[model samples]
Target: MARKVTNTRKWIFTCLAWGVALLIFFPILWTILTSFKTEGDAVATPPKFLFFDWTLANYREVQARSDYFSHFMNSVIIALGSTALGLLVAIPAAWAMAFQPGKQTKNVLMWMLSTKMMPAVGVLIPIYILFQRMGLLDSRTGVLIVLMLMNLPIIIWMLYTYFREIPGEILEASRMDGASLWNEIRYVLTPMAVPGIASTMLLNIILAWNEAFWTLNLTTSRAAPLTTFIASYSSPEGLFYAKLSAASTMAIAPILIMGWFSQKQLVRGLTFGAVK
Candidate 1:
C-alpha cells in the first residue's frame, strides 16, 4: 500500500512536470508553426494552431531580403570569441580566489556579482562613447569584448564555486612536487574541473548569442548578429508576422539544437558538487 501510494504521487508529479514543460515550450513551437503560415494566417483572428496551410515563402523571402549567413557568422564569432576570452581570464581569477587565502576574497566575489545587478543602461552612454572613441563601435572585436566583460563575473563566480568543491590538498600536493603555477593549473586543476568549465562555456555562449540591447545599439550592418537579423523584420509600418517568425526560428534554431544535444553535460555540470 505504501509503494502504491508513492507510485501514484510520482505519476501525478511527472504529469505536472510535463505540463509545465509543454507550457514553456509552446511559444517556440508556435513561432515555428507561424513561420510556415501566410501573413494573414499568422495573425488570424481565431489564431491558427496546427491546421493552417504551410508554406516556405517566409523563409525564402527572409533569405533574399538580407544576408542571413553574415549575421549567423557574426553571432558565432562573437559568442565563441567571448566565451574563449572569458575562460582565459576567469580560470586564473577563480583559481586564486578558490585556493589562495585572502582577507577580502568573499567581499571581492560579492562585489563582482553586484556589478551584474546594475542595469546596463546605467553606463551605456559612457561605454558607447568609449567604443566610439576607440573605433570599436559596430566591430566584431568590440562586441566580443563587451560580451566577454559582461559575462566575466558569472564565469568567474561559477568557476570559483566549482573550484571550492575540489580538495585543496590535491593542489598543495602538486605544488610540493615542484609543479610550476602554470603547470599546476594546466595539468591538475583544469582536468578535474572540466564539467564545470564546459557548462560555463555553454551558458556564456548562449548569453552572448542572445544579447540584443548592446548589439542593437552598437551595431549597424557590419557587425550585426542574428538578433539584428530578427529585429530587421520590424518596421514603422508594421510587423511582418510571418517573416519575423521565420527570422526568429532561424536565429534560435542553432542554439536550441546545441542545448538539446548538450543537455546532459549541462545538467551534470550544474549538479557537479551538489551531491558531495
Candidate 2:
C-alpha cells in the first residue's frame, strides 16, 4: 500500500513537471511550427496548433530578405569575444579576492553587483555619447567591449565563489615548492577550478548571445547580430508572424544547440564547489 502511494505521488509530480515544461516551451514550439506555415495560417483566428498547410516559404523568404550568415557571424564573434574578455579580467580579480585578504573586499563586491541592479537605460546616454566620441558605434569591437563590461561583475563573483572553495594550503604548498606566482596560478589554482571556470564561461556566453537591448540600440547594419536580424522583422506597419518566427528560430538555434550539448559540463561545473 505504501509503495503504491509513493508511486502515485511520483507520477503526479512527474506530470506536473511536464505540464510546466510544456507550458513554457509552447511559445518556442509554436514559433517553430509557425515557421513552416504561410503568413495567412500563422495568424489565423483559431490559432492552428497543428495540421496546417506546411511549407518552407517562410524560411526561404527570411533568407532572401536578410543576410543570415552575416548576422550569425556577428553574434558568434560578439558572444565569444565578450566571454573571452570577461574571463581575462575576471579570473585574476576573482583569484585575488578569493585567496587574498581585504576588509573592503565584500563591500567592493556588493558595490559591483549594485551596478547590475540599476537599469541599463539609466546609463545609456553616457555610454552612447562615449561610444560616439570613441568611434565605437556600429563596430564589433565596441559591442564586444560593452558586453564584456556588462557581464564582468557576475563572472568575477561566480569565479570568486568557486575559487573560495579551494583550500589555501594547496596554493601555499605550491609557493613553498619554489613555484612562481604565474606558475602557481597556471599549474595549481587553474587546473582544480576548471569546472567552475567552464560553467561561468558557458553561462556568460549564453547571456551575451541573448542580449538584445544593448545590441539593438548600439548597432545598426555593420555590427548587427542575430538579435538585430530578428528585430528587423518588426516594422511600423505590423508584425510578419511567419517571417518573424523563422528569424527567431534561426537566431536561437545555435545557442540552444550549444546549451543542449554543453549542459552536462555546465551542470558539473556549477556544482563543483558545493560538495565537500
Candidate 3:
C-alpha cells in the first residue's frame, strides 16, 4: 500500500510539473501561431487558435517593410561584442578574488551585486547626458560598453564561484614550476574552466540580446538591434499584430536556437560544484 501511494503521488507531481511547463510555454506558442494568421485573424474578437487558414504573408510583408538582416547582424554584433568584453574583464577579477582574499572582498562582492538592484532609470539622465556629450548616443560602441558594464558584476560572480571550485593546490604547484601569472591563468586555470566560461558567455549573450529598454532609448535606425526592429512595427496608426508577431519570432529565433543547443553546457556549468 505504501509503495502504491508513493507511485501515485509521484505521478500526480509529474502531471502538475508538465501542466506548469505548458502554461509557461503557451505565450510563445500563441505568438508563433498568430504569426501565421492574417492581421484580421490575429486580433479577431473571437480569437482563432488553430482553426484559421495559415498564410506566409506576414513573414514576407515584415521583410518588405524593414531590413531584417541588418537588425539581425546588429544583434549578433552587440550580443557577442559585449559578452566578449565582459569575459575579458571578469576572468582576471574573479581569479584574483578567489585566490587572494582580503578583509573587504566579501563587502566588495556584495556592493557589486547590490548595484544590480538599483533601477536603471535612476542614472538614465546622467548616462544619457554623458553619451550625448561623448557622441555615444545611438552608436553600437556606446551600447556595447553599456551592456558590458551592466553584466560585469554577474559575470564576475559566476566566474568567482567556478574558480572557487578549482583546487588552489594545483595553482600553487604551477607557481612552483615558475608559471607566471599570465601563463598560469591562460594555461592551467582557463582550460579547466572552459565549460563554466562558455556557459556564462551563452547566458550573457541571451540577456544582452533580449535587452529592450536600453536599446530602444539609446539607439535609432542606425545602431538599433532587433528590439528596435520589432518596435518599429508599432506606429501612430496601430499595432500590426500579425507582422509584429512575425518580426518578434524572427528576432528571438537565433537566441532561442543558441540556448537550445547549449542547454547541456549551461546545465553542466551551473552544476559544476554542486557535487563533491
Compare the candidates by lDDT and give the number of the best one: 1
lDDT of 3 at 68: 74
TM-scores for every predicted model: 0.83, 0.86, 0.85
Tens digits of per-residue lDDT for model 3, 1-276: 999999999999999999999999999989999999998999898899998989999999877777777888889899999999999998888878989978989888889777876888988889999999999999999999999998888788777777787999999999999999999978998898887787789878988999987899999988999988778766825658888888888888788888897776555444433332
Clashes of 3: 0
| C-alpha lDDT score of every prediction, in listed order | 0.86, 0.85, 0.85
Q: How close is candidate 2 to the true structure, as a TM-score?
A: 0.86
TM-score: which is higher, 2 or 3? 2
Q: Put down candidate 1 lDDT per residue, 1-276, tens digits, no spaces.
A: 999999999999999999999999999999999999998899998999988889999989888878777888999999999999999999989989989949999899889888887899998999999999999999999999998998888888878877887998998999899999999978998799998788788877887999988899889899999887677656624558888888889889989987876675455444433332
Write model 2 residue lDDT over 1-276, tens digit each, in one string.
999999999999999999999999999999899988998999898999788999998888777877777888999999999999999998988889899959989898888777777889998999999999999999999899999998887788778888888999998998999999989988998899998888788878988999988999899998998887677766724558988888888888878887886675555443433432
Using TM-score as the measure, the top candidate is: 2
Clashes of each: 0, 0, 0
TM-score of 1: 0.83
* Alpha-carbon RMSD, candidate 2: 3.4
Candidate 1: misplaced stretches above 4 Å? 1-16, 44-47, 236-239, 260-276
